[model samples]
Target: MSTVVETILSNHPQAKRDSLIPILQEVQEMEGFISREAIASIGKHLNLPTSKIYGVATFYNQFRFQNVGKYHVMVCRGTACHVKGSAKVLEAVKRELKIEPGTTSRDGLFSLEIVACMGACGLAPVISINGEFHAGVEPDKIKGILNAYRRKESENVK
Candidate 1:
């Protein structure tokens, strides 16, 4: 009965009621993560089963069940990046964030993920933060980049 659920259902009333995945994706993109209540509400709105909605959500890697951080970091693990020391870059990020891949920091300021490729092989060893790509990164620069994001976040909080 939330406004978000009503709005989404209104927009796609004629859509296949079972196609809740795309609706959930849009909700998550806007809200940063999907809550269980939202999922259930969506199911009710579509007149579909909650179990079916959950099944679709768990089936996709793109869907996140938990809240994500203010910043999401993706390190490319493609062949080109791997050859150019991507593993070291990933390790440095892990140390800086103190969280493994697919997890957000305790403060919800960062989430780290290992991606297959960012399609920037020409700029191997790339990392993306909130969709902003940084190319030709070295281990030494990793800390600085993370620090910069943290600084930006601090500024925003002020």
Candidate 2:
């Protein structure tokens, strides 16, 4: 078993015996997403069926089965934001990140997602990073915003 998987399992041994969903949620939060191996490991540790664990993971949008990047960037594509040029903003972000929506960068520094709405119509063309909203965004601002995240990551690496 991978160290992360072992650590997760060991950290929640009691969780292994019951209620794997919440345990998986906590694991995903720490690891960014769950892997197939993780599901199997969790199943074995908990004595639950893999199918049931997979079902629970699929039932929740909050759970991610694929790997995610260091930063999660979400662009609002709601009607209000659409009218305000969210598409263009999204395009700029894609160009800057060099990855389409629902993809992570090769370096795993960023991932992009498009959401229907964030309920911030007044701040149309909004973008969120790890749930922190940036409102009234312009296409030109995407690079700087991503750069800020990069900068922060670099600082943390030192």
Candidate 3:
């Protein structure tokens, strides 16, 4: 009972069906996503089927199946951003990174996520990398921005 799952379950020693969401959240907080191991452990602890736990998790968008990359790219696609040509910006990013939203690149350099809004509509068509905002982004600017991050990453690795 000293496993990570047991530690998580210990918090809710008397957890019932309603305790599933909280348990999942704690696991995600600890592991960055709802892992297969966590799911199995949770199922065993709760005496519930793995399928049932998975079903509930998949029903929500809060769970992440994979870990985000070093530079997590969050592209805004809200109404303001969309009206400002965010689609083209998103496309440019996809082409540049060769990875779709909710996925990380093979080299572990980047990950993409589509966010509805970043609360900076005035800076529509914006993209944020590692919480740093780039305002008024255009498709043409995609390569330069990515290259900058790539250079920085390489330098950091040195």
Query: TM-scores of all models?
Result: 0.72, 0.63, 0.86
Worst 10 residues of 2 by lDDT: 13-22
Better of 2 and 3 by TM-score: 3
Model 2 agreement with the true structure over 43-154: per-residue lDDT tens digits: 8889888899988777765677667787889999999999999999999999999997767899989888889999999999899999899999999999999999999999
Q: Which one is best on TM-score?
A: 3
Top candidate by lDDT: 3
Off by more than 4 A, model 3: 1-3
Q: Candidate 1 vs candidate 3: which has greater TM-score?
A: 3
lDDT tens digits by residue: candidate 3, 1-158:
32776788888886787889999999888877777888888888788999999999888867776778889999999999999999999999999999988778998789898998899999998999999999999999999999999999889989
Off by over 4 Å in 2: 1-65
lDDT leaderboard ranking = 3, 2, 1
Instruction: List, residue by residue over 1-158, the lDDT tens digit for candidate 1.
Output: 66776687688876776568789977887766777888888887788888888788878767776677889999999999999999999999999899988678999899988899889999999999999999999999999999999898889889
What's the lDDT for residue 135 in model 3? 96
In model 1, state the lDDT of residue 50: 82
lDDT of 2 at 120: 90
